[model samples]
Target: MIEIEGLSMDRDGVRVLDDVSLQIPDRSLTMLIGPNGAGKSTLLGLIARLLRPSAGHVRVDGLDVFRAASDAVARKLAILRQENHILPQLTVEELVGFGRYPHSRGRLAAEDRRQIADALHRANIAALAGRRLFELSGGQRQRAFLAMVLAQDTPYLLLDEPLNNLDPRQAISMMQVLRRAVTDLGKSIVMVVHDVNCASFYGDRIVAMNAGRLVAMGSPKDIVVPSTLRMIYGVDMSVHEVGGARIVQPFS
Candidate 1:
């Protein structure tokens, strides 16, 4: 489990997050939803130890995330940020292999190779494995990055705006991949997403933030109502149940 206590961040005397406390349990997919600049990504960064909190603590299964050894924390949690810019010459497989560096220390063993191959297959990029990163489309490149994170084999995965540049079909496929990771592989996932319907359909729990504060958190059924939508997005929207899923339609 990931426990966050009194997390806060200030940049240039401007507060980004304030007294945020949250517990992310194991084997669940939690979607973070809010408007832009809501500090959703900032909170994820703090938990991943990419950013130091001004005053608070984040513990993953009892290890203080910010104080733990870098490799030790990397082994427990893997993060995929929104912008990943690498050498365009690297092939898909080679990039994914980088995820094993924490375990392999530059020399990949048999098990590392197997995990890389499995991640490639799971991300549906097995056919593109040999192609250069620049040769792939935006959506395919996103999948390649996701494959790298999967190959890391960490128990917790933190992704920021993972659905960016994905088509509708690709978005659904990615969410399904995450769902299987939770149900079958017992991984915990926390992601920032803009699509409310996608969060409603796939998230085991929804965490809503606004202006750097956590405003609401609950199951999709509990948080996908009209009032919550208005509270988060500042828009009036209609929510309807369709085929056991809640769909959000916002007004223009």
Candidate 2:
């Protein structure tokens, strides 16, 4: 389990994250949802130790995430950020191979090769393994990056707006892939997503934030209610049950 206490962050005197405390359980997909500037990404970064909190403690699996060795943290979790400065010349396979750096140390062994192959397959990008990143579409590139993170084989994965630049079909595909990662691969995922309906259908839990604080966190049933949607997004939404999943329909 991941435990957080009194977490806060301030940048240039603007408190982007307030005193937030929550526990994120393991082996499930947790979706972070909120309006822009709600600090969803900030919390994700803090958990990955990419951004240090002004105050608080984060412990993952009983290890201090903020104080642990960098290598140890890398091994324990992997985070895919919003922007990446990638060498566009690198092939998809090469990009995925980078995830093994924690285990391979720049030289890939047979086991590393096996992992790379598995990640490519899991990400549904094996056929594109030989293709350079610059040659793929935005959605394909996103999956390539996901494959890299998967190749790391960490128990925890954090993603920021991972559905960026994808069509509806592609986004659903990505969610399906992520769900499998949680169930089949035994990964615990926390992702910042704008699509509440997608979160409702796929997330094991939904974490809602607003103005830099957590407004609510619970199963879709707890959060997909009209009142909760109003509190988080300040919008009128009617939630419906479709095929056993609650779908949030927003209208003025």
Candidate 3:
């Protein structure tokens, strides 16, 4: 479980996240949703130790995330930010192998190779393993990066806007891959997503944030309701049940 207490952040003397506390249960896929500037990414950054909070603390399974040893934390959690700027000369296999750095420390063993292969297969990118990062399309690149994260084999995965550059089919496939990670591997995942329908369909829990504070957290059915949608997005939306999953339709 990830426990966040009194979490807050300030940028240039302006508050971004208030005193927010949350408990992310283990072995669950939680979706973080909110409007732009809602601090969803900031919160994930704090949890992943990419950014230090101005106040409060984040603990992953009882270890203080900010104070833990870098390698130890890396073993426990793996994060994939939205923007990745690495040398494009690296092949897909090489990029995925980087995830094993925590264990191999630049020297990959047989286990690392096996994990990398498994990650590529799970991400549906095995065929692109020899391709250079620059050669793939946006969706394919996203899958390659995701394969890297999966290769890390951490218990917790934090993804920020992972669907940023994917088409509809690619987006759905990505979500299904994540769902399998949670259900089959028992991984804890917290992802920031803008699409409510995807969250409703794949997420076990939905966490709503607004103006840098958590407004609500519940199952998809509870969070996708009309009132909750209006409160979070400031827009009226209609919710419908389709094939046992909640779907939200926004009206202009």
- Using TM-score as the measure, which candidate wins? 1
Q: What is the per-residue lDDT of model 1 for residues 141-206, given as tens digits with 9 covering 90 to 100?
A: 999999999999999999999889888887888888999999999999999999999899999999
Backbone clash count for every predicted candidate, in the order shown: 0, 0, 0
lDDT of 2 by residue, 1-252 (tens): 889899999988999999999999999999999999999889989989999999999998888999999999999999998887899999999999999999999999999999999889877789999999999998889889988998999899999988888788878777888899899878899998888898899999999999889999999989999999999999889989999999987754
lDDT of 3 by residue, 1-252 (tens): 999999999989989999999999999999999999999989999999999999999999898999999999999999999789988999999999999999899999999999999999977889999999999998889889999999999999999988888888878888888898899989999999999998999999999999999999999988999999999999998899999999988755
Candidate 3 colliding pairs: none
Note the residue pairs that clash in candidate 2: none
> Which segments of model 3 are wrong by more than 4 Å?
none
TM-score for each model: 0.97, 0.95, 0.97
The Cα error of candidate 1 at residue 150, in Å, is 0.4
**lDDT minimum window of 10 residues, candidate 3:** 168-177
lDDT score at residue 21, model 1, on the 0-100 scale: 93
* lDDT of each candidate versus the true structure: 0.93, 0.91, 0.93
Instruction: Report the Cα lDDT for residue 209, model 2.
Output: 91
RMSD of 1: 1.0
Q: Residue 158 of candidate 3: its Cα lDDT?
A: 98
Sort by TM-score, top down from the best? 1, 3, 2
lDDT of 2 at 16: 93
Q: Hey, what RMSD does candidate 2 come out at? A: 1.3
Error of 2 at 24 (Å): 0.6
